[model samples]
Target: MLTQEDNTLLTRTGPGTAMGALFRRFWQPVALSRELPEPDGPPMRLKILGEDLRAFRSTDGTVGLVSPRCPHRGADLFYGRNERNGIRCVYHGWKFGTDGRCQELPTMDSGPAREKAEQNVRLNAYPTREANGFIWSYLGPPGQVPPFPELEFTTVPPSHTYVSKKLQQCNWAQACEGGLDTAHFSFLHMALDDGEDATAKLLTKVSSNTDTVRWMRNDGAPRFTILDHAAGLILGAARRGDPNENYWRISQFLMPNHGLTPNAFPGENYHGQCWVPIDDVSCWIYNYTWNPDRPLSNAERDRFANGSGIHAEVDAHYIPIRRRENEYLLDRNKQKYETYTGIDGVSEQDACIQDSQGLIADRTTEHLGPTDMGIIRFRRLILDSAKALAAGDPPRALNHPAAYKVRGGGAVAPATQSLPEVLQARFGT
Candidate 1:
């Protein structure tokens, strides 16, 4: 549990806050690449880390993330025309390029005054890059931008990955903690009273095999072993399995707000999520699934698109179909017989519970246990980083970008094996 002061520092990430400053040191995804499908397309309004901005693709196919308000008369750039390698304000003929350079000031005559105004009147723009089907931007101070982390999904071919985002009506920290707390799988994502065969069938619908489901169901209290690495922490939860083997679910928690799931065995599609804060009480959960060995099949893509595993069935606006506004379409009868939460999708179930923890979870009035070691360590790591940043020391993860190339997954080993040995056996690190 945390004191109220610590919780405040952990949750609030607006501009000028210590947590916000720490997040600014890293690159953050602002929009999906498909959101700006064609060159010179319409600008999309984006709000990340409580800062309102606009994103557009230039004629050269490069993405531009700049201030949404025009510097001339505070007009919104969403209505501006994207053409000829720049965004032209519809209110006036002023045009700005992807680098925020004032290109043309047609309203002002081509005189000395016009040239000076064109040079001085520039919009604030952040550097952007497209990777892994997402448009990422560095919102920190100029010249201090760090290199992008070598996430495995972003390093793979487009055909080998699928990416999507959904809105979550809760604080980013709590939603992120839910992803790292793998011990909840035994109850939160399991069947209640369904027979073994029916439970296996339901689990299969969510992309898990019967062996994993059985191991999770049989061992509700998993022994945990955590290891600290350069980029982040490796969390391994060992559960009793068949005769001489222990089922190990290993997960990775990267700096800032990224978590790699532990459901995939070898050859299965790997999954991960990044909880980008939209504000103090809302967030956008970006989900990525990739198969490093080969390209994802059409059926697999279709299943992900229609809501399977971590992917939620989202509307055109990327909001989940069953959300807080509709009580997540909960069915009491289904809860009593079909599933534990009466939720149809695993992502929906996660959202439902995490949101139910209130806008920002009150850690001051909570009780934590062994299963919560991952959550505890996560809070410590981030809070310490935030404090260190406040003291003028940058996070070490920023300097070790290549360390982010690690992977996390499941494996079966002897109970005597150590966490490092388990990781070596599974990921060959």
Candidate 2:
């Protein structure tokens, strides 16, 4: 049970809070680097972690994240004038370079005296790195930024990836859980199966987690009694729900933020989920679909963009807002199922199920069951790990160079198979 202090810590968003500080330690994906055109405008406005910031890309394509407000009399830097290598405030014409150093002051005489003053002033800036088509911003101490995870899939050519964003009106935790909860796919997606004969088998397979149950925990926070490989079949949904024996699939959750579901077909058509936190009440879900060889036609893109593709069939579940009798039913249903669903299938297909939870699901009033083992353990992990980080004694990254194959192993193979197969076949699967 969580104490009053723990409960308060969970809800608060401050530097001292466990969650806030833990999140800062990570290099968060702020924006897509491609969003900034090479010859784009001077200063761009970006919002992350509930704070508005001013950013600019150098002519060389380097990005700089800095305080949105100018230091000299506090003008909006977003409106600043853009030069080749720096931005000049529109109000007072004070120029700041990519390094946050004041390069020029239009009002001051151009001489040694002006240079001396400019050298002493520097704008606040966060470290920025561009990788995997995204701009990651490190908000933690300069010395502690962890090495960015090497995502093998993202290493493919630029033409292989298609990206989109889903605006979610919920907390980051809610968005994160949408990916973490594996059991919802069986029911939430059952609507599609109910509507058409073609989808029934696929839906059944997705919902079926009848095999394999293992209890585990990470970071000393929560216990994870997961029904692994349950989500493997759902990856078929992206490829017209193919059930061929030769085909394979996987659903992987990269702890703390993203979800990856990959298809093992002739043409690699992969889907990913990125959770973007925007304060306590809202977040953004960034979706990416990567097809190595088969490029989606404009029509196909439109189908997804217009929500008429597989997304439509999957979204048909959930009660309409006006017809909902109880607001909490959906969340309770989710939490109840997530505890031991035997499989973690996609859950963000519908808003009704999540929105009906009334923003934050209250754990105090809910009943516990053996099946809820997964969610309970997961929550404990977050709470415990977050508390640890909140204290000065920070934990080490789970990546172990010696243990290699067991955890943080860099091997690329189907995750559905057992350890023996993983060892014997290695990359054969």
Candidate 3:
């Protein structure tokens, strides 16, 4: 549990806050590439870290993330025209390029005064890069933009990767804690013991094998071992398997807000998520799945599109169909007789529980246990970094972006093997 002071420092991430300052140092995903599918397309309104912004794709395929207010008369830029490599305010024909440079001021006459105004007038713009189907923006100070972290999904070919986003109605920290806390899988994503046939069917949907499901269900209290690396931490949860085997579900927590799931085995697809704060009370969970070795099949792509694995069944606006307003379409009968949560999808089930923790979880009043070691370590890492930044020292993870190139998944190791041995054998580090 945290003190009230620590909880506030961790949860609140609006501009000028300690946590927000730390987040701005890293590039964040602002929107999916498909949001602005064409050049000179419609501008989209975006709010990240509690600041309202606008995003539009220019004629040359460059994405502009700029302040929404037009400087000329404070008109909302969302109503502007996106054309000819810039956004032109419809009210006064004042145009700004992707770099935020004023391109034209039609209201002014052509003279030295107009030239001076165009040279001095500018809009706040952040640098943007498109990769792995997402448009990422740097919101930090000028000339301090760090290199993009080499996330596996972004490094892979388009044919081998799939990405999607869903709105999570809660503080970003708790939703992120949900991803790092692998111990919850034993109960939160399990099936009721009605019969062997029913258990097998439900297990198939949750895991790659029934044996793994049995191991998770039988051993709810998995022993945890956390290893810190340059980029982040490796969280290993070991549960009892067969006579001499240990079922290790290893997940990765990278820097600020990324978590790689532990469901994959050798030759299987890998999954991950990035929890970006939309505000103090809400967030956007960006989900990605990739197969590094081969192209994903059409069937797999269709399944993901229809909400499989970490991806949610989102509507046209990327809002989960089963959300807080509808009580996640909960079914008490299914909860008692079928699955553990009676939730139709894994993503929905996760969102349901995380949001239930209140808009922002009150860690000060909660009790924690050994199973929460990963969560504890996560808080320490982020809190320490935020504090260090306040002391004029930036996080080391920001400087070592290449160190982010790590994998997280499952491995059946000998019960005697230590966490280091298991990681070495599985990832071959």
Overall lDDT per candidate, in order of appearance: 0.91, 0.52, 0.92
Tell me the tens digit of each residue's lDDT in model 2 across 75-118. Answer: 99888877778888889789888778998788889889888879
Pairs of residues clashing in candidate 3:
none
lDDT of each residue in 1-429, candidate 1, tens digit only: 999999999999899999989999999888889989999989999899999998899999999999998899989999999999999999977899999999988888889999899889999999999997989999987999998999999999999999999999999999999999999989888887555675787677644668988889999999888889878999999999898889999999999999999878888889999999999999999999999999999998998899987999999999999999999999999888878898878899999999999999999998999989999999999999999999999999998999888777889999889888988788888
lDDT of 3 by residue, 1-429 (tens): 999999999999998999999999999999999999999999999999999999999999999999999999899999999999999999989999999999999999999999999999999999999998999999998999998999988998999999999999999999999999999888887777664565676555546677887888899999999999988999999999999999999999998999999878888898899999999999999988889999989988888889876889999999999999999999998898888898888899899999999999999988899999999999999999999998999999998888888788999999999999998899998
Q: Return the candidate ranking by TM-score, descending.
A: 3, 1, 2
What stretches of model 1 exceed 4 Å from their correct place?
205-208
| CA displacement after TM-score superposition, residue 118 of candidate 2 (Å) | 1.2
Between prediction 1 and prediction 2, the one with superior lDDT is: 1
The C-alpha RMSD of each candidate to the native structure, in angstroms, is 1.1, 8.8, 1.0
Question: Would you list the rank order by lDDT, best first?
Answer: 3, 1, 2
Query: Model 1 clash pairs?
Result: none
Clashes of 3: 0
What lDDT score is found at residue 33 in candidate 3?
Answer: 97
Give lDDT: candidate 2, residue 296.
Answer: 57
Candidate number that wins on lDDT, 1 or 3: 3
